[model samples]
Target: MRPLSFQAVRSLAAGLAAAALTGGALAAPAAAAPVHAPGPVTEQGGSGQGARLHTNTELARELKRIEHASHGRVRVRSIGTSNQGRPIWYATLGTGPTRLMYVTQQHGNEPLGTESALLALRSLGLGDDRESRALRSKITLGIVVRANPDGHHHGWRYNYDPGADPEYGEPGKGYDINRYHDPAVAPDDNPATEAAVIQRQYAAFRPSIMVDYHMQGRYAFPPPDGREITTSILWPTNDDVSAGALRAAKQVGVRVHDAFTGAGAVVSQYPGGSYEGIARNAYGLRGSASLLVELSALPQERENFQIRSAAISMVDLARAAASGALAGIDPARADAIPPRGPSLPGGSAAAARGAAPAHDAAD
Candidate 1:
């Protein structure tokens, strides 16, 4: 399939955004698979060969290893400690002028982002190829893997902060780290500890771009007729976000859409609220070109595929930013992406591919 450019897709925005097309130009996976397909090309190539969802301890060790392997080129440090006393690790690669920040696994269950980011860190720190060297020379990449280590250990959404205020998260279970990134709340005054750590890092780095990675429940336009969505993305939607920053964010979104779609994955505009506390909106309000990428949480059998999809996104976008192509992309093209369709019953990818016809429902 010939990939559509922003100019080509803009013409179909009206119809594409309105309804699920049965037989239009919407691209499907290159192979016979359901909506939760992985990208055809990965940064490291192969089927996510060595990617493993790491434990917090493993993550720390891996970061240190990458740091050592880079021979001081890459820096790894503990930003702060989580509620459970685990180190909230942060790693940086490259010394370039264009700064990029990526955070993954604010929600513990969404593990693919962390896995993919590890793969990306390995490639950036160790690869000696021209692209890797160029990326290192042109862009400084900072990544916070498993930002909410407590929640990740618990295999739940919020961080482990049982004593948090009622408005923090679930009060007893833990605070939802995602909801406490409000720029108005200074790091010292923040309720969620992990969020505060991220804020502190943000203040120090002040990245030009911020990409928050997450995973959504399985979703597709009810099988057979409608294709399953592989990934959904959104630019900062907060009203207070500056126009220029917002446009840059949209250009980033368009770049992401092109990257994933070209890799034979379905891409859509994420249905997100304009909550300033959410990382994407909060970071945008702080003058960064921010974006949220939600890869579909496919079945366990396809875990590697999901990792590859996310790695491709991270690596490709970095390359784009490094090469200066990101600045030339049309922000208006982001509007052409269709709003995400319904979540499959029980949030099952299998159900998404095999379920009977049904009406759209909120995720």
Candidate 2:
């Protein structure tokens, strides 16, 4: 790998320093993933028709709207509060053996996921569509619409914990709560209160499938062999993910990608294996098959479009999982798992070059 330019190193150091001063926490030790180069697209709004939720108060208002639209069929609760005292809300839908949990807005700037979730709830409750009714009949869905209120309110990434440094740019909000999935860091060491609440929810609820929705960084990671879009199915430690779960993850990934690619969205591949600091990984450790859906964070104005597409994709996946289509997926026919290490844009070729390691959470 080429050495980082002096200016790049200096910028990184300055960003790290700012994160330290801004109350962000240091992430646990792990090899860093190579950053992807940025894309050149401009931003655009999505097809949804509603004011976006950009603050805690707006989030609350949107939740109320969903509840009202659902006629109380959906139960919304406060899982916990952010460092800034904003409530982290969770909504429960349906009651089936298959539990699918979704967390959105782990990073404040990526607010569209939350909006999409709310919109999805509205569609489920009000739309008479075949997909909506089918999903309502079979699966139990839990949603954490906004996980980082402090950062969101400040229009930053890290919570206002007074420990994290913010100089590392977008993901460098001092501490990354996504990385605190281990039980050892639980109950207190967690910097974002929202993360702790999510941890507790996973332990208590034990959903069979989990999905974390977030916007990607500036760059796009295209799939190997020129695939259009990508979805990452993460394997947690226990190796408890059932054959059914794996099939479901791939089915959902492929279906979502197809929808986006058909709509002219840039698609990419995200290799699936062990991963850490992510909600999907943490939840997977406890026996759930999890997929982390990342939408490229380019063309700031077009984020809304990405968010809407992702939300629609999520709803479709939920319906598919509820209907038993995903559960019955055959793994053998799915796309071959990328060789271990970096296969996507910005991935580490070194990791891909070696034998695939036992699935670890921090990969």
Candidate 3:
């Protein structure tokens, strides 16, 4: 891919700076700055190959298309409005007793997962296709295509809340909807109106599994046990690494690794050895198995590839979860897989040294 435009690079830098000044914790040391690599280039538009979605408008249009195409077999609902009043769209397919929730685009700038989700919806025949029908026959699917509309529209990471905190810094003023861990703040202290509605929906739905899609820093990291693990899945909080969550994560990881590896891409696990705390973990707190799929983002062009691979991975994971294939994976072994190389040096330690504090709706 062509070098990122000066403006695009500058925007990214600014966003990173803003995040540092905010309340979230940083992962790297002050001297160790995050680096950006050039991304690969690919033709734009969906020319009879896999579909490509890059913008909110396109995502919305695709949702409408799926709704129309499904002919009432699938139902689309507006869980609530974003901070900016944009509709937060979710599509529900099937009516099985078990409920599975998939969310993408919680961070506005990470749009690939959202696109992949749209494609998945269209491909599944909106609950009519044989595969979807079979899966739906066993489980209900709830998908939220975009979680932070305000950030998406502005291409920023946080929601549109403008209330700054002295402890968190100026950037912390806007509500990072993902940080609303407590269910007691106004609408449970969630900064985004849309998040509030979705939280309520999930509480009512009581989904068995929740998957949140996102992109990570571009630079590649060493895998566990000196082996590469592409498509890291953040394990939930349960000490039971062998639990259903970990099993589902591993199955999903294998699928993503295969897809990207086939396409000539290297995949690996998070070097930390276990999943970190985030919105996905929060979901886990509520008795649901939550998985956070983090795609590499350092080489920006890879964003598109990661998005596609993630979509494929999600399909495989969803199918397995629906079919009870993931029932045997133990949560205790969540980090059972070892790293393939020397661990990348960054984490809460790096955050303490000078890396910008973590900021974003998911913080």
Candidate 4:
């Protein structure tokens, strides 16, 4: 891999500053009803804004469009199919040796990651600026913008399959695609088809860094008057993860946390478990520095803000990784970041009292 030139780093830093300034502009809330059909309908595109998220067809079109517009700078292909036969597309941008794989929307209900990923695709694929070209020279980005199309179509957490897998979350509903990524399970043998698709892709890509994007319930930091955590992040914590891998994952977390927090988004370390089945831990066990990023599910009125926060984080990470800045980040800084506080209460009265809501496991 070629080293990032000093000029490239300066240019990337300048572009990131510009992105931070522009990401906060809000769009009108999407008025159309969220699309539910699995037809070839185009998705309501923009920041989330409680809008209908992108459908499979729309994602395909956008990926092809980016590929075409990039004049060969970007490439798109179908890695595999979902349980419902939806085309699971993978888009690639940049050609450098440092491979970064991002899988978004593993849970059907979480739409922000996919949305932000699209924004990132456009920026990296279409921009002809020095920073974009510079980053492209040092890193190759492999993005699976939507990993669970069946689950996404059903507007649920699990993939939509009536055929029960051993790890099925609810009978007749489907499997939580996120829970079936254990490296011990062969890609072809994985019961959850989406997990199999992702595992196959991971094996083929052999990325140095992999980031899983997800969404979690709303929470505030430090109780009353505390700021809402717009994004929470966690590194692989499985006991089997190597010390080198853990440190690299922490370095990734610290770089990302600093980038987004500087853009005015509140970020905290997520309270995630060390389950080997979870993607974060599984990928780490496979020797990739894995990080899981969970965007907060805020009220509908703030959907755009949340989308912007997550999207720019993606862009920033790409630039940092490409510029070799990520390699230099202090892993120790990750430990200094505050852990996410308790979930906000259900009612305004309860929230005012800082009463904790019913506890649920962090996805």
Candidate 5:
């Protein structure tokens, strides 16, 4: 990548310095995903259950607003179709050397990320900020605004069509898309006709850095206190992630974590070695610095805060990558944020990290 603009470089340098002083503590990831507050291309006035969740129709309307307002700033497209034949849409801006991809609503119930995503797209397309321009110039951003429209429409997690399930539990019970990126095991045989629409985006986009967004019941990575938590992040818990790539992934994760914390959002590290078929390990193995961002529900807070936290973290990390702040990071340090959570006694380390064996998450 070309040298980052002076401002970008300085911003990166300062962040690196802060990281160094903190001994790379920023590498920790947050936890869980949640539902959204819905409306017609508008911001949430509050948090938690108080915010209106977006119905599929509402989301479609919002996407339309983005497409209409983008002008030439973003290229909107239907990457593929869901099992129910709903189109999976994306908004792409920039042609920078590095491609950054963010896929949200992977779990049909997890719509919180959509709020931040819409806000980000609007800012980039309609707003004229120097930072946004610089960041876009350095990174191509591909956003799968909604990875599972079928689920979104029905308020379910699995795609209803036979195409969404190959082998597993019943349709709605066994179609968790996050659990299907093993590459080695295509669960019941991966095929365009069977593999998920989001999987198609993963294959086609081939981003340099990928972040998958989801919301979960509030709880620490190890279910600490069984209480809810905030945004969670995870690097590759498996051996597939290269040392170098892990470092880059950590670099971005750390920056994003700091961004969230700075914004006053609750954040934590997802216990590693736990979730096997996750996008982090899946795409990381395929050569991308990937992360899984989980937002906590249950003790759900205001939706606007959650969404903006996600949006800020994403844009901040993008800028870090574009500015080369993440390119040359010390992978060792990145990897050393120290794994959290206790392993189920006798369970593998992966157990402590909350990872289940491959091919297990149809729920």
Candidate 6:
């Protein structure tokens, strides 16, 4: 969804942005601020190398390009080093009070969301436009596009030293890097390096909402008659998570869902966050509202016609937060997401191509 409209602030937003930039009316953004100044969308677009997935070299080069293209509006920071010594980076944008952070590709093999984040950067280059101002003037967006560069380089699910190969059962759920970090869950498997970098971002950005993105194969719930879910969303379900935080997460989760469904993605509510070890729950423990969205891996070859609905939802959700609609989302409505799904409304042209009947395991 494009969001209701910025009609209310269309007149004043751009001026406020200019004045904020010139007069320093806004407080200093976090250390990892936006790297580019809102300008022309860089020619080096999307993940540059589609479908093939990016190697470490390719990812590094692109991040640098995004930084340079920000024209100084965005800030790029090397928060920490990954297990293989890759620089884990973050880019910040916008100047609004509502802090937002997007972390993608935590599972090395799931690169779709990372590509989406890159595409989002291209859109963020709009300078002084009313809608752009509406977003930048109301929110601060931070992004960590590659949360698992090492694993991503190895083209495996886990960020293990040498990484896992799909040929061998991809052992330990691709090390299921998502399940580590919180020592309380797995002391032996905790990924202190990557986890620490994320914790640092949490402390500095202090986002009210954070989203972690991933991908899976086709799956359905409620068994026989269940809906085919191309995307599944969930709020942190850690027992100790406060109601306020849970409510906030639910609100964001639902808004993201609505945006995805509105864009015609086959979507569903995730089976609840039974695992506290996941990044969303871990961040929730830090007092920020957090959630995770699992996108169904799509055919990477066709780009133009195959707009990944999950990616569109991700971008729209950020704009929602920027425009302030996300904050008004009802927790009750979010909670209403059944264990199975309401499924995708039929006949929408926005649906992803090649959506198969729900089968196989949930990715």
Top TM-score model: 4
lDDT of 6 by residue, 1-363 (tens): 233234422322333233224322121112212221011112233222322434556666666666665576666777777876888878777888988888887766566676666555545643557877787778888998788776666555556554444232344434555665452534334444465567666777789988988765545555575766667778887898888888888888877777666555556666644556668777787777898887754433322111244445555667777767766777788776655443334412112221212331222
Q: Give the per-residue Cα lDDT of candidate 3 at 22.
A: 33
Candidate 4: tens digits of C-alpha lDDT, residues 1-363: 223345543554454334323323212123324321121123354334334556766667767776777788889988989887888889998889999999998987676777677667766777788867888999999999789777766556778788774553767778888889988989878888989999998998999999999877777888565988778899998999999999999988887787667556789898888888899999999999899998777665565556655666777788788778878878998998898887776523321211112253545
270 Cα displacement, candidate 2 (Å): 2.7
Every model: Cα RMSD to truth: 10.0, 14.1, 12.5, 6.1, 9.4, 9.4
User: Candidate 6, which ten residues in sequence have the lowest lDDT sum?
Assistant: 32-41
Instruction: Give the whole-model CA lDDT for all candidates, comma-separated.
Output: 0.72, 0.54, 0.53, 0.73, 0.59, 0.59
lDDT value, residue 150 of candidate 1: 75
TM-score of 3: 0.69
- Write down the RMSD of candidate 3 (Cα, Å): 12.5
lDDT of 6: 0.59
| Per-residue lDDT of model 5, residues 217-316, tens digit only | 4443355443234666777767757776677677777777666766656566766453446667877887788887875542233444566667767767
The better candidate by TM-score, 2 or 6, is: 6
Write the residue-wise lDDT of candidate 1 on 1-363 in tens digits. Answer: 124455533432222222112212111112323222222212232223232245566667667776766677679888899987988888888989999999998876566677677666665666566766878999999999879777766656678876766474676788778878888999999888899999999999999999998877777754454888878899988899999999999988888788677555788887788888989899999999999998776675575556656766777788788989887887888998888777766675433321111231111
The weakest ten consecutive residues by lDDT in model 5 span 23-32
Candidate 2: what lDDT?
0.54
RMSD of 2: 14.1
TM-score of each model, paired residue for residue: 0.81, 0.68, 0.69, 0.84, 0.73, 0.72
**Candidate with better TM-score, 3 vs 5:** 5
For all candidates, the clash counts are 0, 35, 49, 0, 32, 16
Off by over 4 Å in 5: 1-51, 162-174, 185-195, 220-228, 272-276, 298-301, 328-363
Ordered list by lDDT, greatest first: 4, 1, 6, 5, 2, 3
